[model samples]
Target: MTIRVPVVERILSANDQLAVANRAQLDAAGVFSVNLMASPGAGKTSLITGTIQALQGELRIGAADGDLASSLDADRVAALGVPAVQINTGGTCHLDAAMFQGALSCLPLGQLDLLIVENVGNLVCPAAFQLGTHRSVLIASVPEGDDKPYKYPPMYRGVDALVLNKIDVLDAFDFDVDYFQRGVQALNPDLAFFPLSCKSGAGIEAWLEWLRAEVRAYKERRDVPGNSGTDH
Candidate 1:
C-alpha cells in the first residue's frame, strides 16, 4: 500500500514556507509587521485607525486590510492618509501567507517603519494561518462576552498580545475582566494585555507606546550583525 499524507498537512507546510519567505522580505526592508485578528465588530479597523492616528508623524505605517469582500476597511485606513491595500479573500475566512505576499508588494515597504495587516474578521480561521509578522495580536471586545477566551482557546493561545477592546461599554455589559484574564493566562501566561476602548480613545496612549517600543526593538535587533534575518 502507498503511504498518503493529508492534504491539510501539505497545505499548511506550503503556507509555512511562504511565511518564511515573507518574513525574510520584511526583515530585509527593516519593517516590523503585525497581524491583527478579531471577529466581526471586534474593532480591528478601529484599532488600526486609532494606531495610525496616534503614531502619525512618528512612524511611516502601512496596512493591509483583509476581508471577504469590499474595500471599506482599506478606505478607512487610506482616509487617515496612511498607505493601505485591501485584500478581498473571495469568501475565504482567513488570509494566508500567499495573500500577504501579494499585498506586501503593493505597500511601500522601503519607506514604512511598521506594517499592520488587519486580517479577516474571523477569530478561528485567522489564528490558524501565519502571515510572517513580528507579532500576532487578537482583539477581544467586551460586548463579545468574557467567555471568549475559554471558547476560543486556539486563538487565545496563539497570539502574542491581546487587545481587550470596547472596555468603555463594560458598565452596560456583564463582562468579568478577572474571569477573562484568568482564562487567557491559562493559555498564555505572559501574553501582553491592552484593555482599551477604540470608540472613546481610552487607554490608546498605552497601546501606542507599546507599538512604538516593539517597533524600535525590532529595528534594534535587526541592526545587530548576523541577526538581520531572524524573526523573534
Candidate 2:
C-alpha cells in the first residue's frame, strides 16, 4: 500500500525554507531586493528600465529577469550597463524560490545596492512563491482595467506595494482609478500605491522616490531592524 503525502505542502515548505536562507544571504550581502510581478504587457520591463536610468547614480543595481522564453527583457535592461541575469522559466508559470536561488548565485550581491527580480509575467503563480526579496511590487496597467484587484485578490493581498502603470492612457481607457484603488485598499489597507506612466513619465518621480526610500530603509533595517525592519 502507498501512503498519501501532501505534495503541495511539501513543495511550499521546501520553498519557504529556502526563501529564509535566500533572505538571509541578501541581508548578509547588504543587498535590498524587490520582486516585480505583473501580467504580460503591463510594462514591467519599461518600469525597470526607467528605474535603472533614474537611480543608476545613487544605486548600484542588478536584475534577474524571468520570461517563458528568450532573453528579450533581460537584454533590454542589460543594455543600460548593469549586471542582468536572464531566467527562462521554460513554460513554467512563475519563478519559484529554487529558480531564484540559481539566479542569485550568478549575481554579485555584495557589490550591488539593489536587485530587481522580474518574475514571469503572471498575476497568479508568482504570488504563491516567495523569492526571498526585501519586498514585492505588483504592476497593474490602466489598459488592464480596474477589476484586477477584485478578480486577483491573492495577487493584491500578497504584494507589499502596488503600481498602476500607464496613467497617460487613462484618458483613452475606461479605467476607474478610484475604483481600482478602492478594491486594492479593501484587500491591502496600508498598501503603497503609485499611479504612474512609463510612456510619458508623468508620475515616475513619485515611484522612484518610493524605491529610493525602500532601499534606504532596507539598509537601515539590516543594520538595525525596526518593527517593520524585517521585510527590508
Candidate 3:
C-alpha cells in the first residue's frame, strides 16, 4: 500500500501537468470547455443533444464523447450538425487530460465557441481527473435515487454543477429531491443545480441559460490580460 501511494501520486502529478497544457490550448483557441460526467444510463447523451439543440445557432458547439467502447455518443452529437470526436478508453473507467488532448487534436477548436467533453459514465473515477475544462458537471437521474449524493460524496463535491435528469419520471420514481439537495449542500454549498428532463424538455431553458452565462464568463475571463486560463 505504501509503495502504491507514491505511484498514484506520480500519475496524478503528470496528469495535472498535462491538464494545464490542455487548458492553455483551450484558452489560446478562445473556446469554453465543460467536463460532463455521470453514471451509465444517466441521460448524458440526451442532455448533450438537448444542449446542442438549444445553443445551435447562438454558439458553435463541439463534443468529445469518452466511452469504454463504441462511438454511438459521438454519432449522436454529429447527427445534430455538431463536430464530435470519440475517445474509446478501451475499458478505462475515466477520461484524463491525456485522452482529452488527443480528442482536441481531432476537433476544429478554432471554429468552436463551446466544447463539451462527455466523460465515461462513472460516478467516481471521472471526478478524480481534471480534463482542463472550465466547468465540471454531473448528471444524476431520478431512477438513480436521491441518495447518490450521500453515497458519492467525492463526485458531488468535485463538480461545479449538477443536472438532475429524467425529472419527468419523478412521479414514477422514489427520488427525494430535498434529501438530495441537503446532501449536496453539505458537500458544496454553492454548487449550481439544474433539475430537468431531457426526454420531455421540461426545465431545460434554465440549464441552457446557465450554460450561456458560463460561456460568456469564460470568454470575458479569457479576454483579460494575464489570465492563464486555469480552472477558476
Candidate 4:
C-alpha cells in the first residue's frame, strides 16, 4: 500500500497571514521598515549602528537585532539611545515574520519614524524570508570575494539595495571593484549598490542620503490624504 504525504500549504498560509498583519501594524504606525541581511562579520551591526547615529536627530529610529545566541548587537544599538529589541533565534538560522511581530511589539513603533531589522547573520536563509519589510539591504564585504552574487543568487535577487562593505581592505586583498559590480548587475540589473568602508567612514554619505530620502518618501506617502492606502 502507498502512503500519502499531506501537502503543507496550510503551514505557509498561516505564515503569510501573520505577515499581512505585521505589515498592517507597521503601516498604521507610519514606520519605514528595512531588513538588513548579510553574512557573519560582514559589518551588518556596524552599518546599523552607524545609520542609527546618523539619523538619531533626523528621525525617530528603532531596531530589532537578531542573532542565534547573544544580544550583543542589540546592546550596541540600545547604547545609542534608540529603542532596540533583541530576538534570539535559539538554534534557528533565520527570522520569520512571526518573530518580527514579537520584536515590533517591544519597540515604540508608533513613535518610530524608521524601523531597521538586523536580520540573522546568514546570507541565504535570511533572504528567503520576507519579514514584511519595505526594503531589504544585503551587505557583502570585500573579504567575502566578488563571486558572492553568483554563489548566493537568492540573497542578491531579493535585495532592494546592496552595500559593499570593507572597501578599505581592497589593497590588502585581491578584490576587484569592477568585477564585483558586473557580477551583481548580472544578477540584478537595477540593484542600487554602494561601496563603503564602515570602519573609516568612507562612502557612507551616499547611503545615509539615500535612506533619508526613502524615509521621507515613505512618510509623505503614508501621511497624505487621498493617497493610496499603503501597507509598507
Worst 10 residues of 3 by lDDT: 223-232
Q: Model 2: runs farther than 4 Å from truth?
A: 1-5, 225-229
TM-score of 1: 0.96
Worst 10 residues of 1 by lDDT: 1-10
Per-residue lDDT tens digits for candidate 4, residues 1-232, read 1332233455556777887888788888888889999999999999999998877989999899999988899999999998999999999898889999999889888899899999999978887666888889999999989888878999998888999999999988899889888888888999888899889999999999989988888877876896533534
- Flag the better candidate by TM-score, 1 or 4: 1
**Model 4 lDDT, full chain set:** 0.87
Question: lDDT for every model?
Answer: 0.92, 0.91, 0.92, 0.87
- What local lDDT score does residue 217 receive in model 4, on the 0 to 100 scale? 85
TM, every model: 0.96, 0.94, 0.97, 0.93
lDDT (Cα, tens digit) per residue for candidate 2, span 29-103: 888899999999899999999999999999999999999899999999999999999999998999999899999
For residue 72, what is the lDDT in candidate 1? Answer: 97
In model 3, where do residues sit more than 4 Å from their true spots?
Answer: 228-231
Candidates by TM-score, descending order: 3, 1, 2, 4
Q: Highest TM-score: give the candidate number.
A: 3
Q: What lDDT score goes with residue 4 in model 3?
A: 100
